[model samples]
Target chain A: MSQPRNREQTEQRILAAVGEVLAREGFTGIGVNAIAKQAGVDKVLIYRYFGGLPALLAVWGRSGQFWPRVEDLIAEQPDVLTLPPPERLTRFFSHFIDALRRRPLTLEVLAAELVARNELTAVLEEERERWGQAVATLLGGDDAALWQDHIGATTVLIAGVQYLLLRARKIRRFGAYDLHSDASWDALKASIAAYAQATLVRPEPAGHARQDKP
Target chain B: MSQPRNREQTEQRILAAVGEVLAREGFTGIGVNAIAKQAGVDKVLIYRYFGGLPALLAVWGRSGQFWPRVEDLIAEQPDVLTLPPPERLTRFFSHFIDALRRRPLTLEVLAAELVARNELTAVLEEERERWGQAVATLLGGDDAALWQDHIGATTVLIAGVQYLLLRARKIRRFGAYDLHSDASWDALKASIAAYAQATLVRPEPAGHARQDKP
Candidate 1:
């Protein structure tokens, strides 16, 4: 592989190795040494690729590596906001969900993000607010309530999924990854769309939904 | 105050102080030294009352220290499960939301927790999971799917509220404390109840609901 390709390959190998370790050994279970050892690379190389273990672990948690593929999947679906007036909200929500199903890591990140009670929640809050603002603009409501409903629905769906995963007695018992499945992914998308449609169509406080933005 | 009463009073005072710090300073902002100085209690008392800074902070977060009286207001509400069977879900959801509104800390804690990104989230996930499971049990369908939906919805609502709290100019924004209004609270309660009713009364397939314990 060329040097650029070589770098990509190395980073990919490391992340994959880290995932495997995370699978085998929970978040607290894996360490720099173990991840490096698993990838058959030196610890220094791991540092070179990722600032350190916590940083690497956080990246994995954020699902950054998974977004490109998710974005592609989202692009494959019709944009929910692009439809003619009436259909815009319906189509936008439907396709937004379709995109969510294409990436399991998105769900994983969301599950962790919701229950975050301490210091780490800042990033989660910031990410959702950013998305909420975008969604609010699309929904054509005063940014406040629109973002609230949009972000709230998304957070609960994630928690609900995580709850199910635990009820299945996988992660709660073993701290293991749920073997990803198409049925679950589809369900997540459908539920999200259903919730969003319910949200957008619902009557808002008078004058609130009539924003100048969208 | 009697010794026990005095200690309890002291503990409450300290917890309140910590809450004030967290509200203003964020998690990393407060220190044992600062809390001691701000609280006007001997520094050693913090360690004595709550083992360490982290433990004390957890108490502050969990007890609704900053916003005070939300849980009390919620506790004052009639238990939702006691209502007519069909109305129980609505009542329960409404009551829970009333509690959330009364305690805006529900949103603040959630936002702060996402950023804290430490053992804090682990603690929150477990705590919220238990609360969700309890809500599921109260609803008609306490099965895995219902559990998923109830928990998921709750998580998302909290997230949405947090989204509103975050100053999102690119999207939408809501004044932090001011967003809580009786009418808005009523709407929130209704929305939550409606969503939960839809979920608990007619849960979809496991895969579709994306039910999993996080």
Candidate 2:
């Protein structure tokens, strides 16, 4: 019992150390030696317990620290699906923006992925894809009208949200909004609401629609 | 006269070499020695001609190679401003995407900017800001009703396009669309047009609006 408990404790410490090193120095600083030093353990133990760095990262990726888990996002709004599509989208983006903003380590890895692709990013990418598919199913399975018809538009909104949040890590301003300010984010939320409202709601028949193009 | 011409030619060669090295090895590979060697010139000439790497990069940034020039986008569509706001936006994005996709070097730098910011990115940032301002002005001077009210949506669209394009360098797909596929890009463009049409053309007054949230 003592041996198993001590091993569990050491694994937890090593995992915690990955987060610390990641936050302090970004992905470039991650290594077995670094993690062992930060964990206050022998480097050999890491190989014995986790197999190697890729496996260690894989475990960390599954630990819900890399990206927001679907369960957590849905947990925040118990009746999310019951809401109308537009409101559901607004809530989804609002929760997503909030979730990503809170994870500085995740943001760092996202930034690193832009330039470098290796085992680390590969593991994170797989994790993100899993989360992405889960969220897609939650938002209305891919076969649903909202997703099937408007996937392109949906992609734009989602990719846009990601870019802006990632951009915030480096620059404070993108266009008229100051990314560092909460007020700006609030306005962004409102815009998301407006966009969702506009997108999800089908426009009235062409004859009665306002003709701005002419 | 020949001496001055020879000096001017040397400067051109050094500048061209910057683009070559950048395309080959990215921002990290750029150096006085590398650029000089690529140009078939002495390393001292790079300093004497451009005052060092930062200055050389600044010159390159201004050369219209690092990002699209507003003139080029407008040149592709001379009647851009006369069109309706939605159509104008569609044309602008279409041209913008086409321009960016053509410049692999610009794309490389954009990816690099996400991870590192230094003299190279700083110089490019300033240049991009200059171009961004010009674009804003061209798209309605930032004071028009379209820009004043819908900047958030506009940011989402523009940034989404950028993110997707930058993403294509690494991953072939984003969402349901393959980033490398022209058809996928066409779908994105149509989505942009749809989003622009929805955003720029105000929906009917609240009484007549479709209520999706019940």
Candidate 3:
């Protein structure tokens, strides 16, 4: 029992070191030697326990703390599903942004994902897909159909939130919004709610559907 | 005269080589040694001619090739301003997406911008700001006011296009749309047009303006 407990503690330390290195130096600093140094352990232990960097990162990604879980999205509003679709979207984005803003490590990984396609990012993408699927499950049935119908618009709004939040990690402002300020985020959230209300409640008229000229 | 002409040719070769290296290996491969090797020139020439990597990237960024110019946005639509606001937006996004899609190097830089904030991305950001200012000037007066009124929504739509386009460089699908497929892009563009039409034409009612809970 003592031996197994010791091994688990060492593994936990190694994982914690990955977050520290990632926060301080971004993905470029992630390596067995660096993590082992940060964890205050022998480099061979990392290989023996986690196999290698790829496997280590896979384990790290699987750790629920890497990205926001579905619980985070609905933490404040326990009866989130009881709200109207527009209100649900508003709360969802508000919670989503708040959750992401709190996690600097996740922001760093998201920024890195835009440029690099290494094992770390690959693992993170899988985790993001899982998170997305879980959210879909939570919004199952009628609400899911509504969002799916306007999938393109829904994707754009969510991606916009992601891009701006990721941009906030590096720069202060994007367009009119100061990413660091709560006021700007408030306005952004309102706009998203308004967009959701407009899109979900009323479908675009057929005659107004404009097609690009070939 | 011959000396100056030879120097000019060498400089062009060096700049071209930056693009080559950037496309092949992303921003991480950008350095004096690699660029010099690719250009088949002495490393000293990179410093003497362009004043080193940062200056070289700066000049390269300003070379009218790093990103799409305002001209690219309105190339096919000289009478774009005469159209309605929604039509102008539709045309702008269509042209903008097409221009970006045509320039693989620009997409590479955009992706790199999200992760790393090196000299290359810094120069590119300045160029992007200049291009944005130029677009703003073109859309000055009434149209500008209209866009400003719904700036948050407008930013989200544009950022969505950018994020999705950048994602397409690495992954094939994002949500319901296949990033590589034209049909998917058509759907995205249509959604943007619909969104622009909706937000611009109607202001949210006062009673419906939902403020997030404190």
Candidate 4:
């Protein structure tokens, strides 16, 4: 027998194998045997280390591959919560769409969470709550009644974007937007930004100080 | 062998079985043998009659159960196309949401179409195209550039509503919207109507005659 891998190495190998399966077989190919074979580890290791497939998926989601990673981003920016509401929202959704575009696996995981009522559904809920808190902070401390409506509408828009992009993976043009073209992508992002501005831009009274609370 | 039923009866039985499976086991439970067993018919009959599972789903989708049957609705109200675009869109989406709320199976089927690249996806595309054309007529014929944006945005909204309702079947609340309560439901519908009106409403020249044609 060959030398055994350390715990960190084994975890990394398993996670990398999950990405490999996602790359080769798309969403439908995710399975325990497939992941183990790809990782060159025994299938029992997944149960021992990660508990099960759902936990494994949840761990993979929090890994560097998937995002909104809002906490980490905020840790970097530190004042992202203090920008003007509209600008803050624009940055938030732009980062969101960027992360979504960069990580197809995240979308697949989200799609699975949407469909299946499993352990990962709770993970999705917790992650969404975190994102909601971030947006609420940007929307003026959650006391504004408008934030509720904003969250509802923005959630719909986000879900819609996720569905459209997921479908765009197969068919390019759905309506006015072309998913494959850069111009169309820019137009889509611009439309989203405009939506953010339209929905979240609240006029301040003249000479009102900008709220930059830490 | 017993006396054979006519083609219509067999088809109806198969279709009814599909709904039974959908109602009892949800979207993922649908398969050839299960449907055939539920219908009390040979599995070969599925291929012989409906061509296959996807074709069966497509046929079931176009059946009386699903919503936004615009052709049928138009036949009932010959002048619906002549209404103000905003009012027409509000009514259209209200009806759309009502249909969605009434028919959970339709949402399940739609969710399946969203996730998997199957025959149902093509069916969904064709159905969406038909619905888009109907909406285009309401938005003032096919030439108006605004209709494209309207369609794209409305598509996103419709997809979002579908996703939300499907999730609401399990989790009651995600963000600020409560999907189960009547007050929340009214608020949700109001928001959708507002969205529809916001997206479709446009100023026209005074004395502009509303377009109406077969």
Best by lDDT: 2
What's the candidate order when arranged by decreasing TM-score?
3, 2, 4, 1
Q: Per-residue lDDT tens digits of candidate 4, residues A114-145?
A: 55676556666777777767656655553365
Q: What share of the true interface contacts does each candidate keep?
A: 0.05, 0.55, 0.50, 0.31
Look at candidate 4 and tell me the lDDT of residue B111: 66
Q: What TM-score would chain A of each candidate receive against the reference chain A?
A: 0.50, 0.82, 0.83, 0.73
Better of 1 and 4 by TM-score: 4
Per-residue accuracy of model 2 over B84-200 as CA lDDT, tens digit each: 677778888888899999988888888777766666777777677777778778887433664666777777878888888888887766767788999998988898888777667
Over the stretch A88-187, how does candidate 2's per-residue lDDT look in tens digits?
8888888888888999888888877777666667777777777777777777733376566566777887888888888887766777778889898899
Q: Give the per-residue lDDT digits (tens) of candidate 4, residues B120-145.
A: 65666777776756655765553366
Tell me how each candidate scores on DockQ against the true complex. 0.07, 0.46, 0.38, 0.28
Estimated TM-score for each candidate: 0.47, 0.84, 0.87, 0.78
**Which residue pairs does candidate 2 place in steric collision?**
none
Candidate 3: tens digits of C-alpha lDDT, residues A30-133: 88999998988878888999998888887887774668888878987788778777777778888888888898888888877777677777776766777767
Instruction: Please give, for residues A1-214, the per-residue lDDT of candidate 1 as tens digits.
Output: 2234477787777888877875565433467899988887778877887888767765664654432232342355446444433244444544554555554544444433433332223444555556645544655433445445434344344334433432232333211113255454455445455455434443432465352224
Candidate 2 chain B, run of 10 with poorest lDDT: B205-214
- Model 4: which residue pairs collide? none
TM-score of 3: 0.87
Compared with the true structure, the alpha-carbon lDDT of candidate 2 equals 0.78
Better of 1 and 2 by lDDT: 2
Of candidate 3 chain A, the 10-residue stretch with the lowest lDDT total is A205-214
